[model samples]
Target: SNNDYNYTVDLSDKSLILISINYTVSETLEIPSTYLGRQVKNLSSSIFVTTDTSNVKTLILPDSLTTLDNTNIKPIYTLENLVIGNGITEIPDSFANYMNNLENVKLGNNVTKIGKNAFCGCARLKEIKVSDSVKYIDDYAFIGCSFNKVLIGKNVEYIGDEAFGYFDYILSNKGNSNILNPYYVINGYSSTAAEKYAKENGIKFIDLNNQPADTEQTYTYINDLVAGDINLDNKVDVNDVTLLQNYSACNVEFNDFQYKNSAVTHYITSITINNVTEIQRYLSGYIDTLEIYSVG
Candidate 1:
């Protein structure tokens, strides 16, 4: 073990496998590409499964790592940044699932497959751009997450059920789980798996080949602002709900009064797809009135 970091390893005839890291290492763990004379190729199946990983905020897998050894049994709550190296081809099942604070990820160009529930329940993730080298995305790979945009690559061939564009289950009505639909837009090529998935799930899709041009708008707030009346149309309806969804996905912007009206949860800064659900509930007679949380 001639490496600077303290980590136990198992040596094979040609490569080295990382067993476990000493708890005293830095928060940013950049696994060594080589140890002594052998390529560091693998991590133990139970790597990061312990409570010792509470301090690791940033993790960078080495370029020599070609495979994972069943390490996705649990989530690393503290990990805020991740970088998958170029040699890895598959993202393992439940990789980084439920990581509450994870904000960024850099997937390698060699990655071809994303396994089931790979990034599920990561609410803070604002956007993700899948690389063109990826071809398969397994079920629930990115479900239970909210984002402004998801850019699927053109080469993706198969996308599993609820793999993208769905948010977490926020309400349970009469013993039935009510999952909130995503407000983000999915960007991909026409006639590809991205388009197919977006159509099947009723998510907004933008074709990169035939994208619409951006237009400038002069937004003005009405004197008497009504809650959920996003367009200042004097009445709340499904169109306001659509506008709120678009605003959450970055497809549209809102003026100050419109932003105040969009706050259904009583907190303007906490607006999310759940706010969309509130509007839907009000429209369906499930709720009597929309709560006005931000009254200026």
Candidate 2:
């Protein structure tokens, strides 16, 4: 039987796992957070085969879920966007196999491991920001895909070979026809796996640690700002606090403009967790001003 959200569910160990959607037509599919007073925890691998999902353009998996089971998550051919919620820790192997039209994906902040061949054959996925919480990315996790820009976090302990690039097939179809993208760029910190991988694979590595030289014009731009305004919305508040926390956790990366704003603590070089604390103190009214440190 279908639940209120038209999802077929199975109750296991007092939690609900979605079996499939029973609907005939739905454009955007949002996995229900709760069903019959129990939290929905998983999506059956056969979910896509149970119903017509060709019309679904977006899929939002909520934070209440913890697992996307092993085996290929049968494709939703027309799916263009996918949002994975924060409760999930691992993405099963071959999870999104052959999703050719998939363009954008937002991974949850808590995702720790990306299983083997998890995104195999997703040729249209252009960019992905792997959260700081991810440590292990298994072999061939991103093989057979097209990714031009990837923002890997600081805590990634291991990156499986060919995870983000497959040289001969991943070419730049935009600017110069003969140019390749797999060797273009990878934005990450210095002396990390992200840099090592880029170097070994012939990709251009942009070390987040080594930002552009601060010019006279840059310092002038820095002096005219509130120190804790990491997002630069012209105010220092709780939102800046959250952005600082995310930046500290390596969940988000900042541009030069935001980086200057975040260097509020007394660091000799870069932004650190101390800045987050400083922002908190300022918000609590424990301190009056945020000292803008001169960072090189």
Candidate 3:
């Protein structure tokens, strides 16, 4: 009765069709290319009920597949690799939950929408490449992935709330000190909102409006000096003193000048003059030693 049952029904004029399959074992399954007459457009609900998931690695969806909304089709946990065909446009919510070992995901070129929490909790996922055809990415689509980087394609327009929530978590955690902070380089996004968000959350945002022509542009700060060395010569000395002297004179013509040169020397002279009284007490001792040496 299982083999003879019809798995396909014509729905050319209708909008939807429902089919049922009853299986009692877990094993390698190659879904038939065509069931009855109409092409197998979707995997029926509760089609695979076996607990042993060792043999399942690849799932090839038919071109006619436009939806995979079956609640009982939870075989995604057993699948290490999933290839969605060009016909599918959306992935259901929480479709990839608990799939800790899924490493790579190749989204179809025609897919337009990804549901919320679609790929949450994929801890071992290394990369996600959304195609140019994707227009909307739902909230938390990649919430808790351990991937170090994320590459958003050009066609994406909207990033929902908490889409990068896990990234913030990783940065705040004490264990991830060695991981470099993620830098987000977006071409066309909300400049005001993105700037505000990055500032508040300590995330790095790079504006790519006009990137440097080559690597030489990165060397523009060869002369920038902080507190340690003001002259940019990698050492502090008399030249620094000269700079401070010129600065205190209020000479507006020169750009590099320091006020410490004049102020420090005046302070030292005042200190020496104030200690002249103490120097008088040791002067007689020095004269006595000179007289004894002359007599000898």
Candidate 1, 30-57: lDDT as tens digits = 8789977678888776556643776778
TM-scores for candidates 1 onward, in order: 0.67, 0.62, 0.53
Query: Between prediction 1 and prediction 2, which has the larger TM-score?
Result: 1
Q: Clash number for every model?
A: 0, 0, 2
How well does candidate 1 score on lDDT at residue 231? 82
Least well predicted 10-residue stretch by lDDT in candidate 3: 287-296
Q: Which candidate order results from sorting by TM-score in descending order?
A: 1, 2, 3
Question: On a 0 to 100 scale, what is the lDDT of residue 177 in model 3?
Answer: 21
lDDT of 2 by residue, 86-175 (tens): 988998887886787887889999999999888876777766788789988987787656555677888887888777654223211112
Candidate 2 clash pair list: none
TM-score, cand. 1 vs. native: 0.67
Give the candidate number with the greatest lDDT: 1
Whole-model Cα lDDT per candidate?
0.72, 0.70, 0.47
In angstroms, give how far residue 248 of model 1 lies from its true place: 26
Tens-place lDDT digits, model 3, residues 114-230? 888888767666567666677777877776666534445456666665554243222111222211223333222234443333454444444334442111111111112222132
Highest TM-score against the true fold, candidate: 1
User: Candidate order by lDDT, highest to lowest?
Assistant: 1, 2, 3
